[model samples]
Target: MSLVIGLTGGIASGKSTVVELLKKKNAVVVDADWIARQVVEPGTFAYKRIVREFGTQVVGADRKLDRTQLGRLIFGDESKRRQLNRITHPWIIFYMIRDCVMSVLMGRPFIVLDVPLLFETRRLLWLCTVTVVVVCDRDQQIDRLVRRNHLSREEALQRIDSQMPLQEKAAMAHFVLDNSGSLLALEEQVENLWQQLQCIRKQRLRYYKLFGTICFGILVGIPLCRSIATHL
Candidate 1:
């Protein structure tokens, strides 16, 4: 069985850097953001549902989702945001699980599920053998968002505030990758994490094999022991 690692972080907290390092280590990385975009593509069930619920106003002239428009609508309104999550989160979870299962069946040693909302979703956390959260100071996160996403300070703060706080997520994680310092420091953390995950995967596989062998021995010994008693 493959070990499933749930990777998550607050927006702009350097989760992508950890993901890149995991990829370099040949981990099967299933990105939830990529799945989110694919599931909402034109002609998808999510696309149809979104259009029906939010109307064509959220659809562009090209008949595709106007993500910016949808974002504007949902950002301030909790009800609309919940409605959108209701439509898409299920499909996202379905695809994420399917991909992870496929990886496991293919005999992948481990998989990294890069989900932005892994902790917030609750159910996704149960799927992981280990949960890793990338963390940075709130000011650092806000600055990174402003620089990377080009959002205004207020907008960046709003986006950050929408999710579970970084401290809370870090508390819940089995492993925390701190990105508060240099890239080299972050890379070192990832290297150590990769080594730990490899060790964990091996240990889990060893335990499973031992357990299976014991069960098989018990099954075979039970019949032989009964036969010997009968002969006696």
Candidate 2:
């Protein structure tokens, strides 16, 4: 069985860097953001539901969902944001699970479920053998967001506040990658974590094989033993 690692982080916390390193190490990654976009493509069920709920104004001239307009509408209103989440989260999760299962069936060493809202949804957490959260200082996070996203400091803070607090997520994670230091430092941390995950994956595979063997013995051996007793 492929080990499932749920990777998450707050905005501007350098989670993408960790994911990149994991990819370099040949880990199969099932990204929730990528699945979310696919689920809302023009012809999808999610696209129709989003249009019905948010109106045609959220659709662009190209007849695709206007993500910028939808963001503006939902970000400022908690109720609308929840409504959108309700409409899209299930579909995103369904695809994420399918991809993860496919990766396991392919016999990959391990797979990363890179989700921005892993902690908020909570349900996805159960699907992972381990949860990794990338985090940095709050001020550093805001500064990074302001620079990277080209938003004002206040806007960055608002966007940060819109999600669950970074501290809470870090506390919840089985492994925490601290990104408050330099890029090299973060890279080193990721390398060490990847090694650890490999060990864990090997251990899990052994356990699964042992369990399967025991189950097979119980099913086949019992029937064979009964047949032998009947012959006696």
Candidate 3:
């Protein structure tokens, strides 16, 4: 069995950097954003639904989702954003669950379900053994967004404000990874957390083995015992 960890952070909060560190350690990660894109590929049901709901203006000339346009359409309109989530969240959840099950069957040590909106949606929280939120100061986040995405401060702030506040997310998380300082400092935190999760994985594996053994005894041992007693 795998320990499923839910990893989340507001945009530009260094969540992807943490994910990269985990990947380097050979961690199994089910990325919700990647899955979201997959679920809405041009021919998929989600693509069809999105086009129908928002019209062709949301689609680019290449017949793919104009993510920038869609982002603009929803960021300022709370109702439309919820409507979009309503259309896509279920499909994303389905694929995520499938990936997690596959990881469990493959006996991965632990699986990370990386989601940007883990706290905002709250739909997949029940599936996680532990939750981690990567955080930085809001101003730092906005600055990173502006520098990385080439957005104006106002545009960057709009993106940040669209999600649940970083402080609130940190409060909700079982573990919080602070990325407000140097990359080396953040790496140290990730290393320590990885070690902790490894210990938890070992504990979970022991419990799973014990449970399987007990189940096997119930299924096979009782029948053999009954037969021997009857023969006697």
Q: Tell me, by TM-score, which candidate is best.
A: 1
What TM-score goes with each of the models?
A: 0.96, 0.92, 0.90
lDDT string for model 3 (146-185, tens) is 9998878887888899999989999998889999999999
* Candidate 1 vs candidate 3, TM-score winner: 1
- CA deviation > 4 Å runs, candidate 3: 216-232
Model 3 lDDT on a 0 to 1 scale? 0.92
Ranking the candidates on TM-score from highest down gives: 1, 2, 3
Model 3 scores a TM of: 0.90
Question: How close to the true structure is residue 34 of candidate 2, measured as C-alpha lDDT?
Answer: 88
* Residue 193, candidate 1: alpha-carbon lDDT: 91
lDDT tens per residue, model 2, 24-100: 99999999988999999998999999999999999999999988788778877899999999999999999898998
Count of clashes in candidate 2 = 0
Please list the C-alpha lDDT of all candidates, in the order they appear. Answer: 0.92, 0.91, 0.92
Q: Which regions of candidate 2 are displaced past 4 Å? A: none
lDDT of 2 at 116: 96
